[model samples]
Target: VTAISGSNVSLQISNLSTNYEQLTWLYSAHQKILEWEFNKTNLFKSKFKNRVSLSGNQALSIFNVQKEDSSTYILRVLKESGKEEEWHISLEVFDPVPQPNIEIQKKQEVNNICHLQLSCKIPDQSITYTWYGNSRALAAGPQSFMLEITVNSENHSTSYTCEVSNPVSSKNDTVYFTLPCQLGKKYSWGWEGGHRVDEVKKDVGIL
Candidate 1:
């Protein structure tokens, strides 16, 4: 089974007969963590104390699990009939994903032209990304975090957010792009002193 780091996990141990006389819990790193013999409980001195307990059903519960807790757990049971049995389990733990980092690759307005490219950085591996524009879902489970945007006067004011998620957790980071409307060209012609006069002007440069 798999679980997120810093979360609680329960290792079920059941189906033991009343003849069970001894039991021991073993970890990959440490040998013996807890044991029971002669109808007595024995807890070894380890870093897992205060966070590990056994339930009435003999289920082992580990709290505040950490990355190092990912390992093999072996449970040995000895029956009063001079027989022994072992149960094994494998556990995987992962860290929660951090908030995504938003980077503006391109932001420039020249000659009334603007272009923008934003990047949503994935801080860790095994994570997925999603993009939202103006509170609307734009992309789902995007493999890449780079977003090439087409900024228009009406849509430039739109807001963009990137959500980074993983098996353990999800987080969102937002970015906004506002662009000015492009200016239009105007031309005028008049007659001055019986002479034809023409004037032309263009406006398009603003941030």
Candidate 2:
């Protein structure tokens, strides 16, 4: 029950020994499959060195194997009523690595200073940076920076971060800002009209 079809690996032997007399396979740990089974048994010492033959063309096809070619297969069927049957196969290999993308930026309006922004978009390459606040470690700028907030009268609320890594993959982003207020209405500075002493003496007040 060995299955992997991309690098090639398929072993299905349901008792195949109907007058067959040779079969071998191994890859339990790789050594180049014992140097490809000693160059296909050239040293001639038939304990099936490098394990041999999966078929001689009677419905068994083994071709261009890879994925370490897996291991554990032995079949030496010598039947003429002298009976012999041995079969076993086990191989599993897979490759996968791709799933990373994180971006964040939300902390707008902080007069007197206060800003935090970060970004991370990975699909191909070019990523390696780290910055975290509230989680500590914040001192590595390049992707973005302009934080200088200083208008907190004290109430506690300050955090900023931006961490993105690369060796394979990593992502992070955070933004925070505090200190900017206008609640209802506190704006009064005008000069739309001057004093009027009886409407400013009928208009003598235009100086």
Candidate 3:
């Protein structure tokens, strides 16, 4: 079972028969969590006092799950015919994925083509990143957080999206780029008799 942190999770008991005499929930090896006998339920672990409960069908429900709650749980059932059955369940909890932030690492224009390098920022390394262009998936790999693209007059105003996801949650962010390759110009301004004057100094170069 996979669950997100600060969420609720339920571990259901499958193939349960209605003729069971007793039911017991154990944590790890021998740490008892709860026991059901003679139509009465008793909770054994103080740590799960107000955070754990059993449903009508003997399914275990945990509230406000945390990272420390990831472990193996066992359920033992005793039938009226003196037969015992055991089931082992493994639970894994993960933090929610945060919204991805895209940053431009480098941008330059050469021969009317804009070359750009973008990076996706996130603190967690155990997640996957996917890049999209104009709502279509890019050619980058699932683990690639860096993207390099070239923009020209045909695709100057293109939008890119970065999606970050884990086993339990996902988030995405988008960025748009407008590239206009033209000659760079410089301007000079001066004040003469309380009047502002402006003039173009010179053309720097193609940018």
Model 2 lDDT-worst window of ten: 198-207
Winner by lDDT: 3
94-119: candidate 3 lDDT, tens digit per residue: 88766566666877888888887778
**Cα miss at 55, model 2 (Å)?**
24
Best by TM-score: 3
**Whole-model lDDT, model 2:** 0.36
Off by over 4 Å in 1: 1-4, 14-18, 108-115, 133-143, 149-157, 177-207
- Tens digit of per-residue lDDT, candidate 1, span 1-207: 777787899987556666788988877535777888886778777767677886667777899998788888988889889899998888877777664666668776665555667677775767778877766877766476887756656556356777777656666666544433332222222232233434323332333
Error of 1 at 58 (Å): 0.8
Give lDDT per model, in order: 0.68, 0.36, 0.74
Give the deviation of candidate 1 from the true structure as CA RMSD: 17.4
Each prediction's TM-score against the native? 0.65, 0.22, 0.76
Model 3 per-residue lDDT at 186: 30
List of clashing residue pairs for candidate 2: 37-50, 113-149, 114-149
lDDT string for model 2 (148-206, tens) is 32333353234344554433223344434333321111111111112111211111111
